[model samples]
Each structure stands twice: as structure tokens, then as C-alpha cells.
Target chain A: MLQVFPDLKGRYGDFGGKYVPETLMGPLQELEEALDQAMADPAFLEEYHHVLKEYAGRPTSLSYADKLTGHLGGAKIYLKREDLNHTGAHKLNNAIGQALLAKRMGKEKIIAETGAGQHGVASATVAAKFGLQCIVFMGEEDIRRQELNVFRMKLLGAEVVSVSSGNGTLKDATNEAIRYWVANCEDHFYLIGSVVGPHPYPRMVRDFQRIIGDESKRQFLEVEKELPDRIFACVGGGSNAMGIFYPFLGDTSELIGVEAAGKGMDTPEHAATLSKGTPGVIHGSMTYLMQDENGQITEPYSISAGLDYPGIGPEHAHLFQTKQVRYEAITDKEALDALKLLTQMEGIIPAIESAHALAQAFKEAPQMSQNETILINLSGRGDKDMATLMEHFQEEV
Target chain B: MLTKTSFQGKLTKTEDLFIPFIVAGDPSPELTIQFALRLQEEGADVLELGVPYSDPLADGPTIQRAAQRALKSGMSLRKAIELVPKLREHGLEIPVVIFTYYNPVLQIGHEEFFQLLGENGVEGLLIPDLPFEESEEIRNRSEEKGIEFISLVAPNSDQRIKQIAEHAKGFLYCVSSLGVTGERKEMSAEALAFIEKVRQYSQVPVAVGFGISTNDHVQLVRNHADGVIIGSKIIRLIEAEIENIEKGRMDEALKHFTKEIRALVQ
Candidate 1:
């Protein structure tokens, strides 16, 4: 009913635009037009809804983390179990939608870049399901850290290219992916993993993933009879945060975004952009990013692979600028601590990325009144991160 | 020092020369000064001192790798600007144009950036991210500071091309391809066509960029445009062949890369 992410010129405040090269301009314009037509096309909507519910596993549960919340001393913490989504994490919600849009556009190939490899795994999985050739660009470092995902992508019949340049992180990988897509722009649909990138991407991904908030809103009303006192999620490229944050953009609920502060905020190592950054553009859109003068991309570190990017999604930039949502940094120590506590107390070994939100809950829940409710989007289960976490623990011991 | 009018005066001539690009702080920010001095020593007509962004969406692997090394060595926009003073202190009076994206400029306030650029003896600014339509603020602010805000001319609508040509200061960067900046063996013919269009209407010199890699590419672009801009290829030459650019390897690498292009220019 409400126009999805309606703002000026497809911008989320001061951020978001097709700040791309001329090669992709025509196709991007065409895609924007096609999406407009598809949005109005009932057949397209019907097919999209059908695939979302049946294939990707929609309507994920919003289970309350009562025991964990009780231990934190105050507010009721609810978990929007997006980790239950097939292929893991909230990336699938938009990947399926974009892959379907690719189908409508008669595009044959799918390309994407991944950080923690969750988005790559999800995108490659959807591309396989759609019967399309998939190409994934991952940083060389990510390939080593997320070796299993690389192998999984290969097993799924997708071509995985390791980008070795430019800090070899998510942003660099995304740049390489865009370059690949630009050179091969004729028929490939770039399935951007999150709510970053230029114009239509941030807007489109937010629309598809808005189902998280829509469904959660209804479920909460049905269950608790009131909206959440606060909403929480991890911000990498920040899709899950936006998906869950978009519907409640104007709502009274306080939205909190947790960024990865690897080691600590002061070190050159952390990826806490919002906490220690000024306004700058990275990738395509103008947003807050950790960069130096002369414009060299800084190395962003995080214990959680997903929240390791130096720049956040444009909407988060806008929300942060407008003070609509509060953003804070959660250290690697805090996230790891939260991960273990959630696993021990709730039997939920949440992804380190999601552990950021859990850490936020641990800090904020203590100050919240008992009657107040906090919603934490448990973006993914921690299975993929087990090897890395174990290796980290073994090294520390 | 060339006045904006004097630079514009040079652009009015029909003859084309050479405009070479070098990634500032490629090996290290300290070494970048040496490279700038070396390029000047090597008879470079003009220099595009590329200020490396962390995420250079327009660059290929070669330039990206160079940027990584530079950033790792603590190269900042402030440091790049400071290089102007270092270069001047070293007595190199070549017009140093800061080749960077708009984000860093925006991050360091426009007035301050222009003032620092002017104070440090920077003559021009070539930012790929700042389209001409959104450049009025920068242009107005940079006017008295004697900073020339360079504009890019894409192979697009004649109207937009004309508008860019009219507004462009220093030189009109005529991109050789419609995509991001990179090294390519062959270039789009449409780029030549675009250059011809810009040459016809431009009040400034037309310099071809994006894929003008080899000497042959420069020769080809030279036939139509006023100047040739080569970046990724030169960066690749330095990156691939040498381990360090500072120990005088940068000049040796650039000598080989530039000799190939200069031969064609001659």
C-alpha cells in the first residue's frame, strides 16, 4: 500500500544513485523501467510471491529470546529468525527477487560479489535454482577465510573469481564484480548482495526484503499487541538492517544498527565507519566511509566477516544523517562474547554478523525497562563461521 | 605558473600533445614525489597525479593494487595535497593536477580543499566522480584559488558533450570507453567519434583517457584528440615489473612505458 522506500529521485536522503559508468547506463535505465513495469504487472508480483513463499521459505518465525533477555536484566528481546531462510541469512530474500526480475528481463547470466560468503552462497544458490550460469567475485582474503563457501559455489556450478587487489575485501571484490558485469553487461544480471551500490539496487533490495518488516509487524501486533520499543540488526552492506528497518522508518520504534568494531574503534583495523567516519563515497553512492585524504580505501577489520566493509549501505547513511536510526559499534571481543553467550543460553549459535545485534541487545537490554520489547534480526545461524571461530579460539589459547 | 586563461589559451590551439597520468603514492606517498619529479624530467607535457581512492571503481587490478600499497603506506588526501608543497620545495614547477574522486574532496570541505590545493601550488583538479552539472559549486569556489575544475566528456548526447566542452577548464577528459577506467588492448571507435565531437565544440584541449594504454592507442587517439591520458597501463608497467617504485624503479618503468607512447607522439 505505502509506496516502498519512496523518497526524492530514488534517493534515501542524500545517498543512493546510479553513479556508474556509461556502459551500464542504458541497461540500468532499462532495468529501472522494467522494474517499474514489473511492479505494476500482477503476473510478475504473483510469480515473485509464489517463489518467495514456496522456494525461499518466507514467513520466518519471530521467536522471543526470553531466557537470554531475562539474563540481560531487562527488556524482552525477540528474534526475527531470518537465519531459518533457505541458504541462510536474509540475502536470499532479495537474491530470489532479483533473480526472478532477471528472468522477466530475459537475462541469462547472474553475477555478484560477497563479503562473508553468505550473500555469494545465497545468490549462487538462487542462480542455480533459476537455471542460470552464475559468476561470483570474492576477495582473495575472503576466499581463504570462506573456503567452504568457495567450494560450495563451485559445487553449485558457479564460477568463483578471486579478486586479489585493493585490500582484497568486500568493496574491492564488488568493484571487480561491477567491472566484470560492465564488460559483459549485455545479458548478465548483477545480483548485488546487499543494500549498497547505485540507485535501483538499494531501493529494489530494500523493497524485496521489506517483507521482513511487514511480516514481523503483523506478527508482533498479533502476538504482543504493540510495536517494538526498539529494532536491532548488524550492518555490513546492511540489507537485513534495512529490510527490517525500512517498514519502521517512520514508526516510533527506535532502530539501532550495530557496526563491527574489530579490535577496537581507535585502531586502524576496525570497520566501524559510522562511528569514526566522515561523509565520503565508496563503490557508487555518497555515504560515510572510512577513507583517508587522497582517497585510498582503508582496510576494514572485523571478527565477523559480514560486517567487515568500510562503507555502509546508502539508506543507513541517510538514516544516520537524519538521525532516524542510532548506529553504534560492537567490538570483535563483544561480538565473540555475545556469540558464545547466545549459543550457551539460548542454544542459538548465531552468526558473528548477527552476534553484533545480540551484543547490542546485551548492552541496551540492561537499561531498558522490563515491559519494553526489543526486536533483534537474527540474520544467520553461526554454522558457516564455526571453523573460523574455532581456529581463532585455538590460536588465542 | 600557467593561468587558467593561459591554460585555456593552450587548449585553443588545434595541435595535440601528451598528457600522462601517474598514480600518486603508488609505491609510497614519499616515493610519489620522486615519480612526479621523474615524469617532469622525462619531458612530460602535463601530469595527472592520480590520488588513489581505496575503492577505485574506475580502475582495473593494476591501479587497484597500486592504490592498496599507497593506502597501506599511509597515503591520505591531505598527504597528496602536501605533496604539492614537497614538489615545489624540490623545485619541480610542472602543473600538478590532482586526479581524484569527489568523495575525498567532499570529505575535506570544498573551500578548504581548494585553498590547500592552491596554497600547496596545485594548478588543476580532475575528479571523475564530479559530473559537470554538479560542478558549479566547486567551480565558483575554486575560481579565485586559481584551481581549474576539469570536466569529463562522455561519448553521449551532443548537447551534454557541448555543455561539458563549454564549461570545462584545464582540459576536457574524453573517456575512450563508456565503462570504468582500465587497460584494454583495443578501444571503442565511438571514443574517437566522441573526441572529434568534443574537439569541434570544446573551448579546452581534448584529452582521451580510459583505455589509451599502448603507444599505438596513444597514436590513434592523438590523430583525433589534442592530448592522450594513460593511467592503468603505466601503473601496470610499474606494478608488474618492479617490486618497489621508489628505488628509482618507477622512472625506469615509466621510461619504458613512456618511450613507447612518446615515440608515437613524436
Candidate 2:
């Protein structure tokens, strides 16, 4: 079989490198070699695959969005229901893999950073199942807005620390998590919650979550008997996109990554990194980031907590530069409209982050030909976003 | 006392001059310019004006806190460049080195940056992230424009030490340790041993950086290496002061911090 994971040193087209401090060098190397050995071990893969199937529920179905298709009027659409996963998103696939890896490595604690709190909740749940200590870093503002996920994490026995500095948001939380991990490198394993970070992580998360694409490819062929003409997913830290895009990447399918167009790309209140940001190295890898003259990270703003970040994952940066995928963004208002439309019409209350993919489908479907098949990853359920959406639409009602 | 070129020449002669780095917009880019002048006044042989990147991988909490303050002040690349001309207009003649990452340098094109810096009376450059292998174009262009491009070598790496020592013109920045820059009480014995090893190979003068915080650290390296690079520790001093004082009190507080570092060198 073809090799999926990169070597101990992460190199994805001149973008990924092990730009970590000296202390992390040993553990990362150990993790890399351990993971390499574990991948080949039938027992490890059997245990992981069994848990994903019996416990977490794998092979999530692909539902055709006929109502969304009729509304858009140009092409037929389908939804890859990753929302049907045990954690209501595709994050569990990778989180389960990493948690198992942590157990094998004898790591007693799990550390992660969350923006929308989905990854944190997933990590917290997996940590509880594995009986490992978990600590999650979240922005102070996110703690208030994503209260349900915060409480869920606490209930699952994970301690959630609120970061108050540097805009008090996702990027700042990530920075704080890195600082914490540096001090506790001997005992704690940083789960990194997304496809970004130093090395090994970007590759590891993608390989674990490739189940989304693998299932979608086989399911689509069985259902429609043809490949998708286009595939769409949102790009906040880009794990879900990597999940769905990996199997389709080699195929002749057009991949579209929608980012948050907060107010507008022209203003500072946007999180459309791939569309507006320049190529720069940050957080131990080179990637596209929203930066100022001295290369200080600027504050990113979006209605969706999940989509607000200064930089994209390094692999996505490589993909964007190589033109393998076309990157675009939808405004917060546009995403909210799609959320309401999907909930009211299709009876699917999609998560605000997933609604970003819905909004892109809304835009691109109209331009596509009648025969074009667009597959959108409905990544998470909207149960956690009800309060946020209600508050956003409060002025109207 | 000298022109920027001649000062750069002296820097190249010894191959090491104690170049003190402070974030350009940390306290405010306006005051940062004043701070640069003060460092010159206190005998900072070369001025390293750090561009205050938000995600400073190599720095500790002190510099990170200062960067947060600088970003809040609406600091931009244009404003940082504008300060170069602003300082030169005020007659601060030391070789002002723009110590920055490769992103901003690439954002504003290479030729355009050199032209802007040339117009602003800047004379040297030090980018810690840009290794010698990937810096040939920038190095060639910088040398052609009479701006001495500085390079860094890890303490015990024989190849990097020799490569940097041979081609290094302005100064050789010898990283004191293998980790990020921070404050610590005493220098490591291994670091001292590495510094001794580098001094043997380095034809140009070498300056020890990365956690050289105390006066004792400065004095210890003063014998083996030509100078000391103090960054995060000095920035930490000003960050600690900002919460207590009013806006007008910052200059006095910053001046006191500079005075303490200058006193260490004396």
C-alpha cells in the first residue's frame, strides 16, 4: 500500500517543518516513531477501527439535499452527514485516534485548545472514556458564548482554562496551550484539536479523519455511480475539509474551502485567511496568516466562533498555493441566512461552521451546470449554536 | 560621533557590536524611536529595531506581552519604516538594523524594502529566522547596497559556526542556548563551553544572545564573545511598568530600564 504518513520530520511541500523548542524534540520524535510502528501493528489498528465502528459509529451516510438543490436551481446537492458522528462532528474521528495514541505513549494528560468548543468537547469525551486527565484552553469570550460545550467539557472531567489576553480568542488560546504544553512536556500530550500546529499533527489528523472521504467516495459511487463534480467544506483550522478532501484530492473533483468573510474581506473584522492573508511562517510552520507589517498576528473576528483564526493549516496553505483547491469566503450574514434556510426548509439545523459550507453551496450551485454534483460536508449539528443564532437575530424579533 | 557607513565598518571590523533589540512599537513606535535614540546615547553599538511580530516563536512571555501592547497601538509595517526616516531626521546616526521576520520583508517586495531603508538612512539587517542557506539573494542585495546583513550561529554547531564566521560581515550573533529567549539567573556551563569553542572558529566578533538577562551573564560573555544581546528581559521591565503609570509616565519608566542595562555594560 502507499505510505500515508510523512516521516518523523513533517514536510508537505516546503510548508511543514519541526520548528519546535528543544524540549519538544524528543517527545515529538518518539511520538512519530511510535505512531509509525503503531500504524503497522494489526492489534492497534484493529482496536482503533473497532472502537470507531462500535463505539463512535463510523461510515456516516450521505444524504441528498434535494430541497437545497431545488432552492439553488443550478445543480443537485448532497450532504455528507458527519453531524451524525457520535460527537455531532467529524472531530471525533481524529480525536479518538490521538487519544488511543496517547494511551499507547503512556501519556496521562491530554491538552487542547478550542474556539467553537466542538474539538474540546470531543477531546473531553474521549479522555473520559480513556480515563486520562484533560485540560482545554479556550478564549474568555468563547467560554461565555460556547457555554454548553464548556459545561459539557467540565461534566466529562476536563478542566477548561479561559485565556484573557491577545484578543481573548482562538489564536490566543492556541498560544496559551502551547505555553502550557512546553512546561509539562514530560507528562502531557497536546491533542492540538485541528490540522494545524508544528509537524506530524497536520498529517496525523488528516489520515485519521480520511474516513470521511473514504466513505463518501464509496457511498457516492454506490448511490450515483459517478464522482462528485465539486466538493465543499469550511476551513477553520481545516480538519473537516482535509477529511472529506483527501479521498477526492486525486480524483478530478473541484474542492472549494469557504472561509468567514466576517464583515467583508476589505476590513480587519474578517477571518478569510486564504483569501486575504499572505504566506508567512507561524506556530512552528509556514502558512497563510492575517498579519501586519512587523508580522504581528491581528485579531480575527467572525460570528461563528469556530471560523475565527489568524492562520490556516500548513497543508491547506500548500493546497491553496498549488491551486489544487479554490478558496473563497461567505459573510456572517450570508452564513446565518443559509443556516436559517437549511433549518427551516431542509429541517436540518446545521452548525454555524457547517452553514459556511451550505452558504458556499448556495453560491456555487447556482453557477454550476444542471448535471454537476456538489457534495458538501454537513460537519456538525446546530444544537450548540441555537443561543448564538438567537442572539444574533434578536434585534429582528 | 560617526556616519552610519563608518559605524557599520567598525561593526564589520570587530565582527561584533553589542546590538540591543527592542520591539519597534512595543511602548508605541513613536516612543520606540525615542528609545532607539536613547540606546544610541547609552552606547548601543548597533540598534536592532524588532518589528514586534505577534507570534514571536523565539521569544518568551516578556517580549510577547510587549508585542501585544505594540499591536494594540496600531503598529504597521509602513509605520515601522516611517520611523526609520523619523530617527534619521532627528540625527541618530548609529547603524539602525531592522530585525524582522521574512514575512513583512516579502509582503513589501525586496527591492522596494531596500530602497525604502536606503532612503531612511538604515545600514544593516538581522533576520534571526532566515538561515544562511536560504538568504543568498537578500544577502547579495544587502551587500550590494552597502547594508551589512548579519547572521546567527548556534553555540556548538561546527558547520554553522564556520559558515557564519567566514562570510559574516557586520556581526555574528551566537545563540547562547538551544531554546527560546527568556530570563534566567545563571548562564549554563555548556553554553559557556560552546561560546569558547565558537570564539576559536569565529574570525569576526561574536555576541551571545538567547537568555542573557543578568549583568553577570553580560560580564561572563564579555571576555569570550565581543558583546551581549539582551531582548526579552529589557522588554519585560517596561511591560511591568505600563499597568501602574499614566501615559506620560512611560518615557521615564522606559528610560530607567535602559539605564539599568547600560549600567550593566559599564
Candidate 1: segments with Cα more than 4 A from true spot: A1-10, A17-28, A66-73, A266-269, A292-295, A366-370, A389-397, B1-12, B25-44, B68-76, B82-95, B143-146, B156-166, B177-192, B196-201, B236-261
Best by DockQ: 1
The CAPRI-style docking tier of model 2 reads incorrect
Q: What interface RMSD do all candidates show, one decimal each?
A: 3.0, 4.4
lDDT string, candidate 1, B1-266, tens digits: 21234442333343465676777777766666666666666656677888777666666767777876776677777788888788778767667788887777777888788778877777888776655544577888767776778777665434677777777777777766533245554445666566667877777677778765556666667666777777776676556545534455655765664464445445
Each candidate's TM vs. the true structure?
0.87, 0.81
DockQ, all models: 0.34, 0.19
**Chain A TM-score of each candidate structure, as shown:** 0.96, 0.96
Write down the TM-score of model 2's second chain.
Answer: 0.85
Report the CA-based lDDT of candidate 2 relative to the real structure: 0.79
Candidate 2, residues A203-264, lDDT tens digits: the string is 88888888899999999999889999999999988999998998887688899999999998
Give lDDT per model, in order: 0.78, 0.79
